[model samples]
Target: MIHILGKIFSIISIISLIFAIFTGNLSQLAGAMLDGASKAVTLTLALVGTMGFWSGVMCVLQDIGVCRLLAKVIAPILKFIFPENCKKGIATDEIAANISANMLGLGNAATPIGIQAMKALSKANGDDGTASDDMITFVVMNTCAVSLMPTTLIALRRAAGSANPFSILIPVWICSVVCAAVAVFFAKAFALFSHAGYKMKNARDSAPPKTRESKAGTE
Candidate 1:
C-alpha cells in the first residue's frame, strides 16, 4: 500500500509539473511549493508546544495514578467489548492505557500504547498471521476513537487564528462517537459473518463421506 501510494503521488506530481510547464506557470508552482513548505514548518513549530504540554500532562496523569483510575472505570466496558482478552487477562492493561490516551486526545501518546496493546492482543491470539475478531474490533475502535478533548485540533485552530478555537468541541464529540459506533458495528458484523462461514466450513470438513451403500439407499 505504501509503495502504491508513493507511485500515485509521483504520477500526480509529474502530471502537475507537466501542466504547470505547458501553462507557463512553473514559477508560480515553484513559489507555491515554497510557500507550502514554509507553512508546514510554521505549523509544526506552532504545534510543538501544545503537543509537548499534552504529552507532559499524560505523563503526569500516569504518575498520579489517574490513568489507572480511568482504566478501572472503563474496565467493565473493555471487558464487554473484548471478552476474549478479558478471559485470558492478556493485554487488558495495555488496552486500557491506549483507550485512556485516546480519550484524552493524546493521539501521539496513544500510538505507542496502541501498538503495545496490539502486540499483546496478537500474542494472546497465538501470533496468527490473520487478524482475529478482537483485533479487528480493537483496530476499528482505535481508528475512530472518541476524543473528549481534541487538543491537537484546537491547537491547529488557534494557530490558524480562529476566533474561538474550542468551538469545534461539540461537533468533534458528536462525530467521534458516531464514527466509533458505526465502525465497531461493521467490524462486529463482519466478524460474525466470518465466524459463521468458518463454522460451516469446519462442519463440512468433519462430516463423514457418503458411502456406496448410503448412495444406493438414497437412490
Candidate 2:
C-alpha cells in the first residue's frame, strides 16, 4: 500500500510538472512549492509547543493516578467492547491510556499508546497475521475517538488567527460522538457476520459425508 501510494504521488507530481511547463507556469509552480514548504515548516513549529504541553500533561496525569482513575471509570465499557481481550486482562491498561489521551485531545500522546495497545492485542492473539475482532473494534474506536477537549485543533485555529478558536468545541463533540457510534456499529456488524460465516463453515466441515448407499436409499 505504501509503494502504491508513493507511485500515485509520483505520477501526480510528474503530470503537474508537465502541465506547468506546457502552460508556461513553471516559475509560478516553483514559487508555490516554496511557499507551501515554508508554510509547512511554520505550521510544524507552531504545533511543536502545543504538542509538548500536551505530552507533559499526559505525564502529569499518569503521575497523579488520573489515568488509573479514568481507566477504572471506563473499565466496564472497555470490557463490553473488548470481551476477548478483557477476559484475559490483556492490553487493558494500554487501551485505557490510549482512550484517555484521545479524550484529552492529545493525539500525539495517544498514537504511541495506541500502537502499544495494538501490539499487546496482537501478542495476545498469538501474533496471527490476520487482525482479530478486538483489533478491528479498537481501530474503529481509535480512529473515531471522542475528544472532550480538542486542544490541538484549538491551537491550530489560534495559530491561523481565528477570532474564536474554541467555537468548534460543540461541533467537534457532536461529530466525534456520531462518527464513533457509526464506526463501532459497522465494525461489530462485520464481526458478527464473520463469526456466523465461520460457524456455518465449521458445521458443514464437521458433518458426516453421505455414502453411496445412503444416497441411493434417499433417492
Candidate 3:
C-alpha cells in the first residue's frame, strides 16, 4: 500500500512538472522545488545534529551497561509482550534503548535502535518477511510511546516564539499515557484473538478423521 502511494505521488509530481513546463511556469516550479529542497536539507541537518548527540549519549549508556540494566528492569513486560524465545540478547537491549530514548522524546535517536530491534525480531521470525504477534505488539508500543519530556515539541514551540514553551507538558503527558494505553490494549486483544484462532485451527486440523464404521454407528 505504501509503495503504491509512493508511485502515485511520483506520477502526480511528474505530471505536474510536465504541465508546468508546457505552461511556461518551469522557472517558478524550479524555484519552488529548490526552496523546498533547501528547507528539507536544513531540517535534515538539524535532525542529524540532534540524532548524533542523543545517539552518542545512548552509546555511552550502552557502553556503561545502562541498556542492559534497563532491559533487565523491563524484562517482565518485554517477556509478556514478546515471544518467550526472543526475549533475551541484543534485541531486548535495543528495545530498552529505544523505549528510553522515546520517553526522553528523542525519537530520532530511537530510530536506529528500533531498526536494529526489528531486524532482530525478523531474524527470530525466521526471516519470513511477515510480522509476528510480538512484532505487531512492539510496533504498537513504539508508535504510542509515552513521551515524558516532549523536547522536540518544546523546541518547536520556542522557535515559534511561544511565551510559555513548556505549557504543553501536562497535556502531552496525559495524551501520551492515554493513547499508549489504548493502543496496547487493542493490540494485545487482537493478538489474543489471533492466538486463539490459530489454536482452534490447529486443534481441528489434528482431530481424528471419522471412519466408515464410526459414521455408520453415528447414523
User: Best candidate per TM-score, number?
Assistant: 1
- Model 3 over residues 1-219: C-alpha lDDT tens digits? 999999998998899899998999988987888898887776665556555665576567657866456556666666555556444553876787787767765566788989998898889778888887667878899989887666556656665578998999999889987897788788989978986776566556665453433434523
Per-residue lDDT, model 2, residue 181, is: 78
lDDT tens digits, residue span 1-219, model 2: 999999998998899899999999999998988998899899988888987897787778768877667667877888877877788889988898888777876676789989999999888777978898889999989888898877778889989999999999999999998888788889999998997776566556655454433434533
User: lDDT tens string, model 1, 27-120?
Assistant: 9988988898899999999999998898788778778877678778878888878886798888888888888878876676779988988898
Q: Which stretches of candidate 2 lie over 4 Å from their true place?
A: 1-12, 18-27, 105-116, 123-126, 196-219
User: Each model's C-alpha lDDT?
Assistant: 0.83, 0.83, 0.73
Q: What is the lDDT of residue 56 in candidate 1?
A: 85
Clashing pairs in 1: none
What is the TM-score (0 to 1) of candidate 3? Answer: 0.57
How do all the candidates rank in terms of TM-score, highest first?
1, 2, 3
Instruction: Name the regions of candidate 3 deviating beyond 4 angstroms.
Output: 1-76, 83-90, 195-219
Q: Scored by Cα lDDT, where does model 3 land?
A: 0.73
